[model samples]
Target: MFNGSPFPVDAFPQIIRNAIYEVEQHTQAPQALIAASALGVISLACQNRIDVCRLNNLRGPVSLFLLTLAESGERKSTVDKLLMEPLYQLEENLFEKYTHDLTVWRNDEAIFNIEKKSLMSKLKSEIRRNKDHLATNEKLKVLLASHPKSPVRFKQIFNDATPAAIKDYLCGYWRSVGIMSDEAGTIFNGYTLNELPFINKMWDGAMFPVERKSEPEKLIRDARMTLSLMVQPNIFKGYIKRKGDMAKGIGFFARCLICQPGSTQGNRQITSPVVSTEYLPIFHQRLMKIVNESIARNNENDRLCLRFTVEAEKRWIAFSNNVEYEMGILGRLSNFKDYASKMAENMARIAALLHHFNGDEGDISLLTVEAAVEISTWYVGEYVRLFSKPQEFTLAISEADELYWWINNYCIRLKASWITKNTVLQYGPNKFRNRSKANEVLNTLYSQNRILTEKKGKTVFIAIAGSIF
Candidate 1:
């Protein structure tokens, strides 16, 4: 039923991994099941022997018990009209209204500081408006900036001020803080994983929906697995070889010229051949698990998971086809299938290695060259724009010419520096050899009338020719 094609069978791994992560993410955080269970807790608390007074934190259960008691006719039906229905509506309205108020508070803080000119004034205003609740200015800033549903930043400012004041300042902030703190106290909680930048990125990207219909646990779990796979240690060897040398034994360093019969080292005809050596049985298993779980977990947004699973399957099929075409193991279908599967086992390791190590070149030499060219082009264009005007020649010609002269002088040095500059290197582009080469090329081009020229009031002009005619 998807895109007029039957669902792919190979997507099982991704589905299973996705599902496992989803469940795992859910388990890492606390869940709220207020309706049935909370009411049960309240009913138990009603007994004098149950120490109901001591269960003051049992508001959730008590609320549910009241609803149940009303339904049983011990309380008037008007109570539902007055409280239960309104409470449900109020809960629904809270997320949007609270978030809007927080946003307003965040924006107003800057104006408040600008107008009031004192931290004390801002703090007093907040406390006066919100029932004498006390919070640091920074804490308020962070709270207002974050989503209303998000846990308060109690940990960050806990030591900056007294805990007693913070508890007093925010009206409903305490409830959320308490919930988040309770969840953090548990052994398997968000504290460990949420500290990571990647986790926060994924949470912001996947969560914060107007209505979070998709399960939060699934989001966390899948995001973690994806991130983990991305950051996992890579231990694989790969080589880039010419296409014609495809038949040769991999990892054997015989020249492409020997294999291709007409390729050379300098002017060599080349095609990229990727090879790798790493074992990833666990990764594949996890991937399959995710795919399977996605199919089974039919949430409203399950289509996204299904689509990704399908794409993975299609990629595998394409991979299989490439293997069959390369192996020259012609004829029987079974033989082709077996050969393709074996090739895929090898390819997966290479793919995993390349995923991690592909950008280790820092900035590719060619990319650096392109960037240098772009910078030079921008500078030269600005120079021409500045000098090409006749009325704007109030400054001395030599002073105006100095900018162009400096570019010519430094061109070689700039080119040399551009190529060799790297993260580990403390030196700037002016110190690199590749920048020197680029500068040399620029100078040579300038000398040959390849750079610098203009048009002047229906006349042709050139720098090397020194003519405007």
Candidate 2:
């Protein structure tokens, strides 16, 4: 999965392609990671304003949930910031405006309250003094109707948040939202697994009416959220280990476009131009233009529908049929029904985003749809690579590799040919301190010619293979 085929960057629009390449040159991260970040930013901005027609003929938000798997120091933060710099600036601008609006609302609300109190008192006195109470009552009614309401704070992105906090903000406070992180342990380990169903609803753009004990029950509609997380490979595996069954059972992982791109650590040689001053600024400006257009219109039900043209619709339907038929019992996609079924919709969504970003008029074209297909087909292949085999074996292989390195390092650092098994039992990795577990991993190393073990009179010793005796 880590060495999967490279993402189809050439298929992207020229505007996005240029920035991706620029980020790659500067960050030396995998292009796929950078691409995911770019798409996530687009999705977050477009989700509030645009709706695309899916195969079901129903309109769905052009939003995406992207999860990219990379190792530590893979420049996840660098890639995320490079793509989201424009959005960060937009948030700061919105916050400043909101602060001013809130202050004004406070003053108006206080005056409104004072007027209402005086009007009520006058109405009571008019009734007591046998005067015309109808005029005072009418005045009070007008004042009550004109009561000031506070401004709604507009915040679009959260680096990390819980389900409740997300609901509070995205469901009503802001129509569009995104939750992104470079190191995503806070998201994965912060009780997010328990709230998979909440995220699933957000992905489908389904209406969510939440029940509250102390507050009014809220009905949420026309809400959109995009989630993008870049986690280390180990944390990625840990998430699968803990919630694989629940996530698969409820089709949550199926809703995400998960990519495990290969690393580019040692290959980043210093180049003449260390940064991309030109391309990134251009991309940020264009991105800001798109986002500002969406927000300025205050589009709620007024959606800019991105439908497929005649030929593009045919292309999409053919792809959808092929995916359905390939999910048969004896079919190639039999083992991947959950993920394969969702890929075509994602293709349409991605195609719509590409079309709109390029400022194409009318319907989407077959050329754009084909490009989306190329990208989605690679995602199916990557999903199969990660989930085809039993995960237990994968975990074992990873542990074996770790133990082998630790053994070799221990032996070399101590200037010893072998280490006593008792020492391993006492001082090795915590999980391998036991006899049975240690042997399970040691036997794997032995079979791979990484280590040799000997027993001498009830004591066992292990040494790195090919070491001088």
Candidate 3:
């Protein structure tokens, strides 16, 4: 029921389009398929030190938190495996390379620790003996300071890790990393540990404070992360039910680019798998190119500052004005103004990604900006359709109210004071859906003193209070 066309994969590079196509051919889940590919690209882009647009002195990082909702049989895991295979391979390779260096560093660190302790003890002993042993204390300080620092493990991808763990990883390795998961329940369940603020702060590019009682001297700042999670709709709905307004109020869910793709269940046809393909090679090549660039920049401590061309800047302004105007109009996009307001920024990031993927230039083109605008417009429609309600009723109307209104109107039309439970189930409005839901509504009505329920011979009947036949 998502009332929008599928994401425009054609606007991206050919390898991405082909990869999506190949995955869709196998899985028959186009939305999840495309989302996985796009998330993969964004993950790589975020790993690189790159800024997308500089408009009015505001620079946006090409990082996004994307959430895809689908049912259990939607092949989300399959898509994830296919798209994230490269990152897994890269991680393995890095680990293998770092193993020997880590071993050497560990031995050196052990020796350094002993030396540092000896120096500290010597300094304390000198100070205690002389009370004015500044000369000896200074020599001990120099010895302690000359010890080699310990080695840290380098990591690129994390799956279902706590926010604090992720922060530590980012601090140790590259300053940026990606958090990806097929079953997003782990991330949602982490809220019990009160990790929302950490997650939110990371998304906003704010400084993170890593406090440690043992290492009070270490300071961690400017850590960045991107998130990609695919969850079932039922789990998402349950999360909303449990958290209520807190989810929206905290802007945690608002920062996500959410997509509820249509189900492809029961429509899959068996077909022979494509044997040899050029898509994977091309995909890996493009991805590795970006990964190499990011690694190079990280080594050199340089970040690419991308600026929009003059015409692209004009186009972006126009797009922003149109989005603002549409969101400002009552009943237009008022239900999802928060998401609408971020469309331009997200588009800029996407445009920057597209620009980088195509060429190595640090300039965004008008064509890319236009493509970003088109894609953002589609995403806005998706958001609206996902959250919008019909004019006759709002989401605020409770199921009990809807059922009560239906039953009251039905009895009044029939000029009857009472209706049997079977009749209500059979002839009530479609909002009831099933007898169980209808019974729940009936129980609510009876509990509220709005209706009278009587049971006789295994039959239940309900009558509206203050009603006349």
Q: Which candidate's TM-score is highest?
A: 2
Model 1, 1-469: lDDT tens digits are 0011211112223332233233223221111111111111212111111110001221110010010100111112221122123223433465567677778777776565554455456788778888544555765565455432432322111112222232232222221111111111121121332223332232222231111345232222111111110000011011122221332232111110000011111332234343221212333343233333432342322212101123333454465564454333111122223223333322222222222122222211222222222322222222232222243444433432443344334444544221211211223234223544433333333433434433335432223223222
Model 3, range 370-443, lDDT digits (tens) per residue? Answer: 87787676667666666654635343247767777877888888888878888877887775658767765665
Q: Where does candidate 1 have its weakest 10-residue lDDT segment?
A: 228-237
Model 1: lDDT of residue 40: 19
TM-score order of candidates, top first:
2, 3, 1
Candidate 2 structure, TM-score to reference: 0.79
- Cα lDDT of candidate 1 equals 0.26
TM-score of each: 0.15, 0.79, 0.74
Model 2 Cα lDDT, one tens digit per residue, 1-469:
3558989999998888999999998888999999988888888877776789966577887888888888888899989888898788878988999899999999999999899889888988888999999988988888888888778777888766768877877656567788878888888877554688888888888888877799988877878878888988788778788888998989988988988988888888886765667888877887788788778776446778889989999999999988886564324566778998798889889999888877778999999999899888887877877777554677899998998888888988998899877787799999999887887677667645687666557776778888754
For each of the candidates, give the backbone clash count.
42, 0, 0
Instruction: List ranges where model 1 is wrong by over 4 Å.
Output: 1-89, 117-469
- lDDT (0 to 1) per candidate: 0.26, 0.82, 0.70
